[model samples]
Target: MRLNTQIQGQGFPIICLHGHPGSSQCMSVFTHHLSQQYLTLAPDLRGYGKSYTRQRFEMKEHLQDLETFFKEFNIDECLILGWSLGGILALELALKFPEKVKGLILIASAARPRGNHPPISIFDYVYTGLAGLINWIFPSWRWNIETLGKRSLFRYLIQQHTKITYHYLAQDAVPAFLQTSGFATDALNQALRLGYNRLENLSQIHCPCLVLAGECDRHITAISSQETSDNLPNSQFYYYSNTAHLFPWEIPQTVLNDIDYWLTQHPEIFQSN
Candidate 1:
């Protein structure tokens, strides 16, 4: 399938992958800045945004789709930067195709199930439990048919998933949420069940890897990210204060600068080995 992608600038290629249940639009905050410095391409994963659709997808499928996506775009190798679920895929890619991946930049990513974001609101408490039950009792396809396809209803649900107050949401986040919502709920359900841990193989990853997170990130706590860094054979970890899960969006300039410095330190990574 021809995944719809947004490409800008013209330099070393850097592909940005968004989180589960999110489309490439969510990466716009970072892509907008990175595009000026690198040849950036952001695509809506299958079943989300303008990409091909399916009833469900697991982590492996996402990785495979991305492999094909790179080939179609004539990208043999380049930097792989992923946020949240996207970061998991980036790790898998590096493991599976070490020769094709030059380096990795993982943001708000972990190797195991994420702990609950703290200060859980009363709404999140109830909603989280409800979502868990829904995943267990129902198939992802059924939920996508019944609820995921409805844009308006999905938007409301998006607001509830965040730990942040809505005081700034409608103005700060909802627009992208609305545009990025047409994804299969099954993909997200599979992710929650993914428990996508590659602890044993973390040391197997030899490519230069950088993992970043927000100290205040509720989605995937900084503690887990630190562990991921600790296991990596060649890696570095950094966290920002008062930040949350959405690092690329929450602190675009910092992410941009950090990535730039890391890449600069290893100019050889620019070559696909």
Candidate 2:
């Protein structure tokens, strides 16, 4: 299973993983910024983007596909940068294959599984359902933007419901998200069918970690973010003020700068446990 991947730069390899409703394309700009200091390899995870051709979506298969991706690329060990769901995968990789991970950078990630995630209130559900319907009806990013243009409901969804409020959604996120081809639906179902959540396994991961949190994020509560950092054996947690889930896209330079500072402060070369 050859996942569609994008690679750039030439230093220490940094595997980039996007969040749910995310794709490598959505991550392209972010990785490009990181490419100045590290070799960035961003791939669309299975059941997402270009890899949605599989018959079914399974958490185990996603892990296996990544393990295969590493071997196929001859990546013995490398740093990892993951967002949200991908962050969970990164932590899992570090726990399961300690030698294969140098360091970790997780953004807007939750330690607990989706069940622990905050549920959308009934009022916000209206916006979420509407957004879902729009996504279902118009897979085209341009069409979605034009369709939802300057509408109060769109604003409600962006600012209150999802808090993505991303200008790039029309150009980057929505386009890459559309490429998921409705695979997230199946994947969401698999989450319940498989009953997978590694909240109890945090201590197993020993790699140095950098956890970035958004102060204003509603998707993941501040207390949960703090608890996630507290659980990690080695982690530096930073919360950006006035930021939300789309903080990386909203302020790439600030996010990149913080990441650079964190990486520089850590061991220049990791001697894995």
Which predicted model would earn the best TM-score? Answer: 2
Per-model TM values vs. the true structure:
0.77, 0.80
The runs of at least 3 residues in candidate 2 whose Cα sits more than 4 Å from the true structure, single-residue gaps closed, are 113-165, 192-196, 269-273
What's the true lDDT of residue 145 in model 1? 25
Residue-level lDDT of model 1, residues 1-273, one tens digit each, is 567888988888888887765777767767877788789999887776777564555546677788889789888778888888788888888888887778899988987746664354566545544443443344233453244322222222222333222212333344334444344556667667755678888888898989998776667888889899999988999988766675555456677899888988988887645
Per candidate, the number of residue pairs that clash is: 0, 0
TM-score of 1: 0.77
The TM-score of predicted model 2 comes to 0.80
| Model 2: lDDT to the true structure | 0.71
Q: In candidate 2, which residue pairs get closer than 3 Å at backbone N, Cα or C atoms, i.e. clash?
A: none
